[model samples]
Target: MDVVQQRFAEWVYKLGITLTERQAEQFETYFRLLVEWNEKMNLTGITEREPVYEKHFYDSLTIAEAVDFNKTSSIADIGSGAGFPSLPLKIAFPHLKVTIVDALAKRIRFLDEVIAALGLDNVTALHGRAEEVARDAIHRDHYDVVTARAVARLSVLNEFCLPFTKSGGVFIAMKGTDVEEELRDSGYSAHVLKGEAREVLKLKLPLEQSERHLVIIDKKGSTPKAYPRKAGTPLKSPLVDPAASQ
Candidate 1:
């Protein structure tokens, strides 16, 4: 095994994920494709071997700290730029049923290429706005977990993600550590969208040691029909707990 795979295995191993030799090869293949395709179009700014392994690949797996993929079966990733957290999670678990939604068709194309090249199964890439896609019955309230990474604020992200989370399931917002203000601001969005806020979980990236966070919100019930507003409303006018101004 090469140094990248060796170090990646050691890191995720601490998270209770043991990588088979094939899994290691799959990650190597994924890394090559990421750099190759990125040259053609905008996929990710971080494309170097070690940083991709550390920030993109390993950073994605840190969700394992907040979630038990062994117990979870399905996940939906919203505005999944470069498929952080989901693609890596799929590579690690292999059993996960992953649905990735992105508004940009080009990114969807990249994800499809990666899935096909990696020989991954049970993964679907859809091209559409998150708001409209979440309205589909098959996607609505149907995932074991829903995730968004650096997509939007907690308030705006709730509208983008919570609609896809199954009742009793969880929506995990992957973010940088400065989320305290966002958590306070997102309370109304959660309440309006039928999610109960959970404490933000934190973990640091290896080597870089920069703190990352997972903002967890448990789905209390089905998304109210009025929710999510329209395609762009959630971004333009996110719900805020009016009482917070008091």
Candidate 2:
């Protein structure tokens, strides 16, 4: 193995994650494709071998710390820019059924290509506004777990993600920092959306030592139909405060 692979393997091993030879190969292939496609369009700014291995690949797998993948079968990643946690998690746990939703067609195309190249089964990429997608009968309240990786604020993110999680499922929002303020701002929105803050997990990235927070929200009840609003409404006017009318 090369330096990047060696570091990734070590990191995973240190974290008590088992990395089989095949899974390592898949990650290597994914890194190669990410760099190759990034040259064509804006796939990611962090394309260097080490950073990709550390920040993108390893960072994505950090979600496993919040929940046991063995118990979680289905996952939906909203605004899956560069397919962070979802794709990496899917690669690590081959049994997962992953659905990635993104607004940009180009990103979806990249995800599709990556899925096909990796020969990954039970993974689907959807191109559309997350708000509209979540409102659809097929997607609404259907996933075992829904995730958004630093997509937006907790309030906006709750609308984007909570609508898709099945009752009793969880929405895991990946954030960089300021998790406390986000949770305070998002509590009302979560309540409005029929979700409750379940847990908040903090961990530092192995190499960079950057702070990461996984805000886990349980979908205790059905989301109000008004949610997600329209395509761009949630971002423009999120439910930051329950009293504020949208």
Candidate 3:
């Protein structure tokens, strides 16, 4: 194994994830594609071998720090810029059926190429706004785990993600250091949407040791019909904690 593979393998091993040779090769191909397509359009800023390995590959797999893909099957990644945790998790755990939703057509095209190149089965990349897609009978409330990584604040993310999460499933918001403040603002929104903040998983990245928090919310009941109002409404006017703001 090379230096990059060695580092990634060691880090995932600690999380009870073992990478196969083919899986490692797929990840390498993914990196190559990311770099290649990145030249044409913006995919990611961190494109170096080590940073991509640590920030994108390893950081994506950090969802394992919260819930094991070994047990979960269906996963939806919202606003997956270059297919983070979901794609990496799919590589590590081939059993997962992944659905990635992103707004940009270019990103969807890139993701489609990546899926075809890697020969990854049971994975799909959809091009549309999260709010609109969540209303589709085919996708609405149908995931075992729905995830958004650094997509938006918890309040907005709750609206974007919780609508597509099946009742009793989980929506994991992967955040940075501003988790406490985000959580405080999100409690009311979560309840309004019939979700409950279940747990917060705090961990650090391997080399840089950057702070990461996975806010796990359980879908206790179906989201209200009014949620995710429109394509841009969530971002324009995010749900707020009436008490906190007052």
Candidate 4:
């Protein structure tokens, strides 16, 4: 095994996660492809091998520790730039049906090519905006888990993710240290979307000592249809202070 692959394997082992030999090979292939494609497409800025293993691979695996995978059969990764958590999670748990949605066609193309190259049968890449895709009957309220990694603001991200999550499902947002403040700002929209902050899982990765928060928002009921307004409306006019509006 290469240095990157070996370190990744050790990290997973230390975290009490096991990947079959085949799965490890798949991840190795993905790592190589990401490094190569990034040279041309600027898919990611973290080019160092060790950083890729920890930030991209291990960071993605943190999702497995936070949620019950058996309860979650279907998931959508919104604005999946470079397929951070989705691709890595799919490789880790192949049974989970995963879809990666990105507005940029180039990123979508990269995801598709990587999936095909890895012979990953459990993932799909869609090139479109989240709001447009979520509005469709086939996609609306379909996924058990809707995830976003470093996407929009908390309020805007909630609008983008909540509409697609099934009742009783959860929207897991992978965020940085500002999670508490974002939650405070997004309280009204949380109520509007029938979501409540369920839990926050703090991550610890190798080499870097930064806070990664898994903000879990449970979809208790159906979101109001008016939600996820046009492309920029959520950011511009979010549901701030639900009681005042009522």
Candidate models: Cα lDDT each: 0.91, 0.89, 0.91, 0.85
Q: What residue pairs clash in candidate 4, if any at all? A: none
Q: Per model, state how many residue pairs clash.
A: 0, 0, 0, 0
Q: Write model 1 residue lDDT over 1-246, tens digit each, in one string.
A: 888789989999998899999889888888998899899899889888998999998999988988889999999999997888899999999999999999998888899999998999999999999999988999999999999999988999999999999999999999997898998889889999999888788889998999999888999999999977889998888898777667
Q: Deviation in angstroms for 145 in model 2?
A: 1.1
Q: Against the true structure, what is each candidate's TM-score?
A: 0.98, 0.96, 0.97, 0.94
Model 2, residue 144: distance off in Å is 1.1
Best lDDT goes to which candidate? 1
Q: Per-residue lDDT for 1-246 in model 2, tens only?
A: 777787888887765578888888889889999999999899888978898998888988888887888998999999998998899999888999999999999999999999999989999999998899998998999999899997898889999999999999999999998599888888888999999998999989887899988899999988787887998998998887646555
List model 4 lDDT by residue over 172-235, tens digit each: 9999775787888887788888899888888767768888888999998987888778876776
Off by over 4 Å in 2: 242-246
lDDT of predicted model 2: 0.89
* Sliding window of 10 residues with minimal summed lDDT for model 4: 237-246
lDDT against true structure, model 1: 0.91
Candidate 4 accuracy as lDDT: 0.85
